[model samples]
Target: MPRWGMVIDLEKCTGCQACTAACQMENCRLPGEMWQDVLFYSEGEYPSGKLTWLPRPCMHCENPSCVAVCPTGAAYKAENGAVLIDWERCIGCKYCMIACPYGVRFYAEEKQKTQPDIRDVFPAKGDKVWDPPYKMPEQVQDPKHGVGVQPKNVVSKCTFCYHRTSKAPTGLKDLDPNDPATRKFTPACVVTCAPGARYFGDLDNPESNVRKLIAEKRGTRLLDQTGNRPQVYYLAGEAPVIPETRSVRKPKQSPET
Candidate 1:
């Protein structure tokens, strides 16, 4: 069985929010329902300060707390090591949301609002006042791989782009970051990253880039004290230091003669 994992090189991340925007569009998510986010923070003194841009996604932990706390069996681990939720089984209990250490899950009620200019941009057709000019992508209709057009009242988070991941070849357990097959089956966030800082593959495969990077870079996980054993790893602490330069003050002019 394949154990899917991710490695993010923080040293290369520029805090651009490109991954975040790509995720939203790929999933057709509402305005504030971000499955991927870039957390921005600063370190050191002024002029010499370093800005940290951390990209966060679902960890898909080896031992997921969300799966254990779910009152219903809605939350479960997939064969590919993805922590997933079945909307049909979810009962809006919020237990999984509370149990998640990364704060990635959100209530579907949060995405219930209609887009700002529905009436202006998508005028209704004759006789059909409710019909909009545009509709959601066809891929979202498959419940086996998607949450569907409306994921109302349920808790939702990243699925590692299952619609694409599940398309990997029959014999392969997981995708390889270097393989063309893998490139065709990767998540939107991974492929859209401008800095090439994100990698995804099977951790169980010794030759996979994800495993290699974690070993070579000494990747670290978030909140390791919880022992959730997050599959997502971060490569940090090696960013180049920037020098600071202070402006020189001129001496006061002598009194006019």
Candidate 2:
């Protein structure tokens, strides 16, 4: 089995939120509920300040903290090395949410439904209808994946688009467009990304493009200090720095002493 992982290049990302939107539509997530998000940070003084943007997703740690603290064992590593939530087994304890340093896990408060006002599922001018077989009224239901028809009090997060991955035909397990091995490979986010910042593949394979990017760019994992061994890595940007200066002021004198 290959160790599946994703590499997001911040240098290449424009903070367009394309990846974020794609993930939501593909997973049919509720409004205001996001499986992936882009974080913005600033450094330095006003004139020379630099802005940095980072795209965050479920780290899918090799030694996932979410899995360790889950009382119900609902969060576990999948066969393809993706961290997944077992909705049926999940008790909505929020332990995984607390344990995850990346803050990727979320609990669904209200059942998520497709908005009636929205005409298209994606902004690319396509039909907004639900894919067949997984379709349901308001909320989708899948007995095999134990998703879509989630209970009111269950935790949910990124599954690496497992619903699509499981059905991926053989010889298309990876995401290499040029290679025949990934001929049928497609992930909702990866497919919808207009900038092509997100790259997914078998991290265990040194020959993989993702691995090559890691090697050449020296990509760094987020919050590596936590020892979570996150599979997601980031490529940062170089922005100008600004300095802060302080001035001394005279003390106030007593009036009408």
Candidate 3:
């Protein structure tokens, strides 16, 4: 079996959220739940300040902590190396969310970070959380692989577009979206990347583009210290860095004079 992997060239990335939009449409994700994200933040003082954008998707770790923590065996690492959550078995525990270093998982039961909930704006016709204004494309509807319109109260994340990738020709090494022949089986986010920054291929194959890029470009993983062994790799002159840890908390107030 081929070990799936992705390589993102930071130099070619323009921080466009095209991948984000395509993922939402392709996967039938909720308005605020982004499977592909471009995280933008500023660095340095006024004169030297600049914005840095990091595109993030599920790392699909070789040793996924999410899989370790799921109470119902919902989160699993597939044979091809994609980490996926089964909507049917998920208990909405959010343990996987807590375990992920990339903050890529979403539990839709919680209120969207953005205000004026879009679910209310466009209500679903049936048991789905909400129906989108646009017609959702037909999907394989395999809840075991989380491939379809999500049900209520389930945690979800990126699946590397499994529904499409699974259908690619057997023994194929790479799934380059730019190739017309392979386009039909390519992931939506990979296909929609405007700058052609993302690449997907069989990491175990020496001839595969992903493996070649990782060798030539000096690919690096985020939070490598955690030992998740992420299959996703980044390439650039200065590889994008993610802090090993983080938390949100209010600052302490000084005692009143």
Candidate 4:
């Protein structure tokens, strides 16, 4: 039983939205519905200010507050340590939304539908776009689970692409070690990262890359003060030094004299 986890190196992250896009496309999320996001925080003076880019995802806490507050038991910590939602049981009460400190939980406003009047198109071969038949309302599918339907009203967030990871071919489950096609079990965002800043694996395995990263990089979890024990860890980045500023003195009024 592996406790799946993720490590995000803040030093290597460039604030690119590739991971965000990849997750959305893989998960078939609707427009404006994002499971992961890179939040930017800045402080200090303009010339020499510090900028921090924090990529936030479902923390999958060991003691998830969302699970505690969910009256319908929609949110719960899976055996693998991943926080999961049972859409069928979710009553859209949004109690989990208020309990979540990371702000990862999202309530689907309305079921997504493809308008028949609008011409649909997709990339064909080398062509950028090809006209296709009008598509009707389609539910987001989990490619691995073959479950492509999301209930009308439920809270949703990143599943670490569980459907993809679990169904991966026998030898392809581990991304760090593999041979060609057999090495493609990485989560959608991890696969799409240009800088390879994100690492995923069983945190419990001492030999796993994620565990090694935590030991070597001294990764820290966000909001440790809350005692949520989030599975996601972050490698601290160099803090930008802000130069001290002095008040400028007005020039002597020689012309007035």
Question: TM-score of every model?
Answer: 0.80, 0.76, 0.90, 0.75
- Please write out the lDDT profile of model 2 over residues 119-169, one tens digit for every residue: 234231121222323333443344234345345567888877776565555
| Clash pairs (backbone) in predicted model 4 | 141-148
The RMSD of every model to the true structure, in order and in angstroms, is 8.8, 9.1, 4.0, 9.6
Candidate 2 stretches with Cα past 4 Å from truth are: 110-149, 169-173, 177-184, 237-257
Q: TM-score of the candidate numbered 3?
A: 0.90
**On a 0 to 100 scale, what is the lDDT of residue 19 in model 1?**
90
> Could you give candidate 4's per-residue lDDT for residues 1-257 as a string of tens digits?
67778898877888898889887677656555678888765555546655656777788898889999989777777766778887767777889899887888876554435533221333222221222232212343442221233454567778877764554554322454223553366677888888888887788878788888889978788878777889998887564321122113322432222
Q: Could you tally the backbone clashes for each prediction?
A: 0, 2, 1, 1
Deviation in angstroms for 149 in model 1? 2.9
lDDT of 4 at 198: 85
Which regions of candidate 3 deviate over 4 angstroms? 135-139, 238-257
* Per-residue C-alpha lDDT of model 1 across residues 93-189, encoded as one tens digit per residue: 9998899988899875542365674333544444221233234455554444334343446777888887777677654644644568677688889
Q: RMSD in angstroms, candidate 1? A: 8.8
Query: Which number leads on TM-score?
Result: 3
The collision pairs in model 3 are 124-131
